[model samples]
Target: MVTAIVLAAGNSLRMGTQNKLLLPFAGTTVIAAVVEQIVKAGLQELIVVTGNEPDLVHQALIHLPVKLVHNAGYGTGMTGSIQTGIQSAKGNGYMICLGDMVLITAQQYESLNTTFEKAYHRDKTCICLPRFNGVKGNPVIFSSAYKNAILQHDDPEGCKAIIQANNPHIVWVEMDDDAVLRDMDYPEDYAALINL
Candidate 1:
């Protein structure tokens, strides 16, 4: 089974005082819309890691059947939340999702999972990543074999180091759109999302 881990613990430092995940998108909040697509994709389990404003995030996702985990160290960086979510995950594989990337469709999420499952069955240590054209994108999936590596990851930049070290294990899945590459980081980014 694959557990979807939605990382919603950003401080929105670039957005200046606003939490991008909580901002309005698609008639619902940003994080909720992102999670809703994953829920629709029918992943085995879903875990959302909250920080900044945990209560508000929870309320945004109150109707979804997802497990919410509070990452006390979220202020540090994304790696801490990644570790926190991995610690609570109960699956053979994990899909690390970003809450701010609201444009990723349910079909995209399923495509990643389908590729991960097929590759994981052949190699239990495989990692699945989405690529648009030749560019890599967010919401990567990793087999449980690398759980310890992810937990022990020291880079505040997140899991790039692990991906670099395990090049041979990566299964690059091509995506149909650039949605995986876009995330709401600033006011302009939000504007672009709304305009689309």
Candidate 2:
């Protein structure tokens, strides 16, 4: 089983004043759209790591088949939330993604799965990360071998340092979808994704 750990925590300080996750896009809240996409992609076991507006996040995800885990130290940085989500993952492997990243389709998700599946078949403890137009993107697939190493991370950003140091263990897959690269950091990000 592969669990999708969606990080929905943080105070959204850079977003000015709006709760970007609750903002509507395509008729539903941005976070809802993101979670629904994961559901539509057939990932049943999902863990949502939330902070800031925990009640709102829970309310928003009430209809979905998702488990909510609160990030108690989310105010520190993204890493704390990521650690919360990672600890909450129920599967042997994890598809770690960000909630603010909207516009990903089921097809794009399949592409990610395919990349990791191929690497996993080789019996290598590999990571499958998307490479969009020569740039890295989210939803990195981590094999079970890195579980111990990941647990050792105390940095707020979680897997970044581990990912950087173990680049050789990662297999980057080329993707055509720019949505994998889009993250809603501000109101302008909402505009940017909409325009794209």
Candidate 3:
């Protein structure tokens, strides 16, 4: 089993007063869209970390088959949310997904999962990351071997440090879609998503 950890706990400081996760995209909330893609990819287990507006975020995903884990330390940074989600993860491998990344598709999620499956079959401890063009993208999947390392991570850079430290274990899956590289962070990003 593979768990999809959707990090939706950010305060959305860049979006001014609006929570980007709650914003409407493709006729649904941003977080819902992200989770929908995860579900569409055939992933059954999902862990959503909520902090900023836990109630609202929960409301957004109330009908979905997902477990909501509140992160009290979310104000610190993304690492806290990642840790919170990992604590509830029950899969052999986990994928770290961001809620604000509304453009990612179910096909992309499956692609990453496929790569991870191949790596797991080889009995290799690896991290599967999607790459758009030459840029790395979200929903990074990693074997359970790094769960403890992710929990112990305290850097401000989030889990990128773990990826950097384990570069030799990374399996970069090249993707032709640019949606893998886009995320709704600012107002302009939201506008662009709307336009798309």
Candidate 4:
């Protein structure tokens, strides 16, 4: 059972007053598009970590088959929301996804999952990450062995520290698509995605 944790707790300060995750994108809400990709990937479990406008985010994803986990410490950073979702993760490995990365497709997620399964079968401690032209991207899959380490993380840098510290365990899955590297952080970013 592989779980996908959608991190949607940020305040979206760069987007002015609007919640970026709830913004319309590709005929659906940003977060919904992300969740739909996860679901289409055939992941066994889905957990959405909500903060900022949790109610609005919830409303955007209410129809989806997902478990909502609220993070009161969201103002702290992304790590808190990740820890919140980790608490409910039942899979031997979990994928960390960003809510604003609406362009990532189900095929891309499935590619990550496929790579993760291969690496996990070879070594359970393996961490599978998608990369495009050598640049790392979102929806990274980490073995449950690092759950405790992630929970103990206090740095503002979030999981990047763990990945950086454990480079030997990383299996970089190269992808042809650039969607993994795209995320809406500002109004212009959202506009660009919409125009694309």
Candidate 1: RMSD to truth: 0.6
> Cα RMSD (Å) between model 4 and the true structure?
0.9
**What tens-digit string does per-residue lDDT give for candidate 2 at 127-183?**
888888999998888887777778678887668787888888889888876878888
| Cα lDDT tens digits for candidate 3, 77-147 | 98899889999999888899999888888998988888898888776578898998789988799898899
Instruction: Give me candidate 3's TM-score against the actual structure.
Output: 0.97
**Scored by CA lDDT, what does every candidate get?**
0.94, 0.83, 0.89, 0.90
lDDT of 4 by residue, 1-196 (tens): 6789999999999999988898888888999989998988888899999989899899998888999999998999999999999999999888999999988888889988888888898888899989999888988999999999999999854788899898999999888988989988989999999998
> Is candidate 1 or 4 superior in TM-score?
1
Which 10-residue span in candidate 2 carries the lowest summed lDDT?
115-124
TM-score winner: 1
Clashing residue pairs, candidate 3? none
For model 1, which pairs clash? Answer: none
lDDT of 1: 0.94
What does candidate 1's lDDT look like per residue over 71-93, in tens digits? 99898899999999999999989
User: What range of 10 consecutive residues in model 3 has the weakest lDDT sum?
Assistant: 154-163
Q: Give the TM-score of candidate 4.
A: 0.97
Off by over 4 Å in 1: none
Instruction: Output the lDDT of residue 24, model 1.
Output: 88
Each model's TM-score, in the order given?
0.99, 0.94, 0.97, 0.97
Which is superior by TM-score, 1 or 2? 1
**In model 4, where do residues sit more than 4 Å from their true spots?**
none
